[model samples]
Target: MSDFGRKGLGDQLKEKAQPDSTKSTLDQTKESASGLYDRAAGAVQPDQNKSATQQLGDSTRSTKDDASNQGQGILASAQETIGNAAQAVSDTLQGKK
Candidate 1:
């Protein structure tokens, strides 16, 4: 069977690893535009009216968005940890702590 409409494991991992800040300007714009389109389509064609494939697509998009958000949270936490470590080193060097 063809899984053409589905995201592969590698693609999902890549999406999770890539934070929005790292995306290029064009890529970010495209995502934003696509999101707008999806929202408009959803408003015009609610879930109850959507076909099985379309519903699956929406569900997949939601799951991907959630994963990306979680990944961003993890990335932010890592950055915070690194920043705190750097601050501690600076304080130690300055004899403040």
Candidate 2:
């Protein structure tokens, strides 16, 4: 066989022995995309560390605390009003006119 023909066969064999560059790059791209998707899923994941019932319990506790504070404020205001009314009644009864 001519040296040129032998060289051509050798080159063809080398090419076949090597993986296709385009297919290799495409596989890498697929793996990168899969990794990105996994990270995004993890980032957007709700506090999986906490259950729904636990979160609800915390919210309920906060709301109860808020209501308790509001009730205390109202009670304070009512007591003040009553004290003022009592003072005014006592002053009127003493007839300081």
Candidate 3:
């Protein structure tokens, strides 16, 4: 057989482990958002001038904002992880290093 014909499927295949770049990046973003949310919540204090109902409304709004922000962060992080995993799989199948 010719040299080209003699080459097996293994000979043309190459693999290299893909390094993950998302972990630290995602962690930092999550941490930063958490810190920001905490600071925002902490900054809200009972106002002596405001009525009881107004105070309650302010507290409720702050809690809601914190929950909503945290939920969004979780969702975004999950999506990023899934996308990274998919990309890694695709790269591996293509014999990329």
Candidate 4:
């Protein structure tokens, strides 16, 4: 082969061998851009909204506890009435009159 042709062929081979360098640079640029996007996303805050939501959750829990206690009291009262009725029936049957 002639010298110029050999030189041209070598240059083509060098370019082919170094193709990954371009891809590496592109990947690094994508990483930097993604890092910037993450930082921007992190900068956003929901401070007041979060606090309000927590307060609402606390209020709901308190209300549920109150309702549960009220229901328990009602059940206890019904049980007491049943017990009294059973005692009266037993007294009448055993000739307590």
TM-score of every candidate relative to the true structure: 0.62, 0.45, 0.50, 0.47
Per the 3 Å backbone cut-off, how many clashing residue pairs does candidate 4 have?
0
> How many Å off is the CA of 64 in candidate 1?
0.6
lDDT of 4 by residue, 1-97 (tens): 2121122323334544665556577765765565455334323433353345333433454586699999999999999999999999999999885
What tens digits encode model 2's per-residue C-alpha lDDT throughout 1-97?
Answer: 1121122333334444666664577765765565455334433445454345434433454586699999999999999999999988998999853
Candidate 3 residue lDDT tens string, 1-97: 1121122222212111223354477765755565465345435543664445445545665697899999999999999999999999999999996
lDDT of 2: 0.55
- After superposition, candidate 2 runs with Cα above 4 Å error: 1-49
Identify the leading candidate in terms of TM-score. 1
lDDT agreement of model 1 with the native = 0.69
Per-candidate Cα lDDT values, in order, are: 0.69, 0.55, 0.54, 0.53
Best by lDDT: 1
lDDT string for model 1 (19-72, tens) is: 988999998787667556664664466677676666676677678779999999
Clashing pairs in 1: none
Backbone clash tally (model 1): 0
